[model samples]
Target: MEESSALPRISAVDLFCGAGGLTHGLVRSGITVRAGIDVDPACRYPYEANNSAEFIEKDVNELSAADLRPHFPDGDISLLAGCAPCQPFSTYSRAGRSKKRGLDWQLVNSFGGLIRDLQPTLVTMENVPQLADHPVFQEFLSTLAGYAVTWSIVECSKLGIPQTRRRLVLLASKLGHEGLAMPEALGSRRTVRQTIAKLPPLEAGQQYAADPLHIASSLSETNLRRIRASKPGGTWRDWDPELLAECHRKATGTTYPSVYGRMEWDAPAPTMTTQCFGYGNGRFGHPEQDRAISLREAAMIQTFPRRYKFVKNGDPVRFNTLGRLIGNAVPVRLGEVIGKTLIAHVSASRGATGAGSGNAQNTLF
Candidate 1:
């Protein structure tokens, strides 16, 4: 086996990089991310400020290989990585909808198109697990004709992330590596208490002066009372008849019991969604505090550093904007796993002929 110092140097570019979560992880695993590309101008500050990578603010569809080649340094192993938007493939999306519709699929095809044009030595992608069953994923797979490919549904908690997110991860190598795999599960699962119990407490409508992102959204008078009565890991069924919403009073409403609930301190948090800051959102209430989780807490659950800055100084912290960025981000811990796996795969394939010489799965935890 080759030593750590013997591993090939890798340079990468991130597509659809929101606030630089995946880039940050890859950097931690010793990959040089030259740039991140996205359409949202709002992502530029945090992406460049934290990741030390250039932020190209443009739609991915319009970008060509000529526009990207300059970023990759000569003689380095080239890597192309990103998480294209996956909301249309989400379980919450309309069921049984035709796979042939929407701009989301178009964005995914744009990614495949880049791979065809550039032919990077390595590639990685992350998205919702449901993407595995969609036709769009098969279409994306067809683009890698000469590459060896492997993919799986990765559980975030098993990777030491504090959230219960399951993602579809894909790895492909054009360098003749076989059976390239995702990283093995770590020692233990992280819990909500271990992740966020030490932050200063806040009321429903309060903001912490020390950390602006610690601000919680305001609750209505009835919501305040409802939260007070809510028990850890318990549902709104614990509420009194008068406190129940009109939806909850209906027979069909009982089906969605996870809404308006408190998180269990010992358990992993439910997946963070775009509306994660709202009290009425699914299982978002703090276990002890009488409010929803703050933006900092949400980012932390996604394995982002607490000091990760989403906005500039003097800029007002808006709940909707920050929530979307945090929720849509790839968990940084999972990204590290991808980076480690790729490093091991590339190292193991160095002397082999169209077959892997070692098991990369059990190598790193």
Candidate 2:
């Protein structure tokens, strides 16, 4: 192989780069992200607008090593981040396994195939913790035969993301140094108040004029009443018996207490889901507001900047689309932590200095 002629710097390609969350964090942490590839065209605008990286709309399964080589340039240290969509392996996915699950599981193999073919200097992957137990994960691991690998189930709250999400994080190095370790957890957990309290509040179904994404969904009369009765961090059990949904009154429904709940201002939020804007979805209702959290608030909990653009100037803000883009994104803070870990490992291996301070600050909207 010919030696790269460019100056030494970490350059990365993000797979499944929903709205550029991982790319933004990598850029923030001093890594040069060359491109973000995802099948969703909805991601292109935000991915390019926010990170200043090329957005390639292509399915990962259809991409070849040659298709990616042009993006890495000649001499930059190449890093590949493959954060496949995790819904197939997520606990939130349908209870029983099916052909659809089998199909999505192959995405992990496609990611592994890219690593095998490209053999980049560094590799990282993030997914739901449940994936670690699946055979697909073991098959993916087999692809890193020559690299030193380390993986752990990381708590997002410990990493300063104000959500109670746990994920599997893996780092692999082919540079003959120790595999990169996960960053140390922060001194304290961030809370809902700390992350989104300063934003302008909105009533149910109201939109903030200055920022379109700050709008909350309209609630039905019953849900409006349900949210009114909810206490911060409390479940449907706190609701007046008359206001209870039939499901909530049933034995099986009791298993789903977190639904129709309000997030506690003093605590981190529950995981944001694709349906997070709906008042009845998970514990997404605002602490004091009698409605589900706004799109902007949900993005902030996922660690996206308050002003992070989702919809374009004239486009409509479809709740389902925006919610999936934000909720499914790897938290920006978690991505930064992963980027810093890779930078440290590369710096150690090459006996060279790492880029920037790695203490990435949030950009204003």
Candidate 3:
């Protein structure tokens, strides 16, 4: 029976599963990701192709526990993972606003309600660090008081991801006084040069012939000249007087000097946003190339595997659509850490139960 019986596993569903970044990482750590739910139809190809999970192209607000139950298996620990769109909570988006709330905000509430209804054995969520400040977040925390909740703010670069992003990672379990711990960091920081140095070089607006996605966005003649003058780790202040944008002369624009800057080769990249493919957005210019980083390069910085196909063959690689997908994704390496942490918790719980029963051999990790 030991040979024939299935090993205990945690079955998971990824909510708002953009391009399956988190799902891919968790799957790598031995979790059975049963399905991914998102309203974006564009995510279907990558999410389904990269993992053995069904893709549900529907609004999360319309889903219920009954609808989700069929996706998981009959006998196993049930888990739910979600990272709702974090735009409203982002510092960049809320720069001048007094208040912000929208449909995406409601999605967070819906996620909490689903958890309350399903009462899964484990739950995990990742989002912008700013999320913890909002009233909605406080409401969400109230829902978790019944469970053992552990959350922390982490820098992605410390976790072996090349981009410099700060995020909130939360893990909750109903299995008695569990705490989520930060995964051990790489002894040294993972730098941009260490991540994307060896790929064949390409000019602005050029694509690698072997890979359709390894293409950079086109730069205008004026911006092209401007990029040439910009030094790595330098801002618009490095530019010639003639190449400066009109706003840069103003005090308000001086506050946003990181714009039109190049990334430092020896350091982790600035946080990639939806416009990471554009030269004027943030500090997205390539360290040496006179162009913004390519779509493939951005995904790699997000710690996705090199050959993780995002689109089908013969499809045109559209920049805007893909930029949204890659920028909003959780780093795959972080997801793998969460999976391993949860797995260890399950093992520890089983070991404690076995000790109580005086059957030391009953636990298996």
Residues 1-365, candidate 2: write the lDDT tens digits.
Answer: 96533237778899988898888888887788889988877888888878878999887888898888888877778889968775565544421212233468767899999999998988999998988988999999999999989999999999899999898999998886553789658658999999989988789999999999999999999999999999998898987799998887788997898998999999999998778888787999999988899999999999988778888897898988888788788999888888877876776776665353344454211
- How well does candidate 1 score on lDDT at residue 135? 96
How do the residues 171-261 of candidate 3 rate in per-residue lDDT, one tens digit apiece?
A: 8988864435656575578888988887778889999989888999998999999999999999999888999888998889889988888
lDDT of each: 0.84, 0.83, 0.80
Best by TM-score: 2
**Model 3, which residues run further than 4 Å from truth?**
1-7, 91-102, 352-365
Instruction: Provide the TM-score for each candidate, comma-separated.
Output: 0.91, 0.92, 0.90
For candidate 1, write residues 90-169 as lDDT tens digits: 53432112233247788789899999999999999998888889999999999999999999898889999998998899
For model 3, the local distance difference test gives: 0.80
By summed lDDT, the worst window of 10 consecutive residues in model 3 runs over 354-363
Clashes of 3: 0
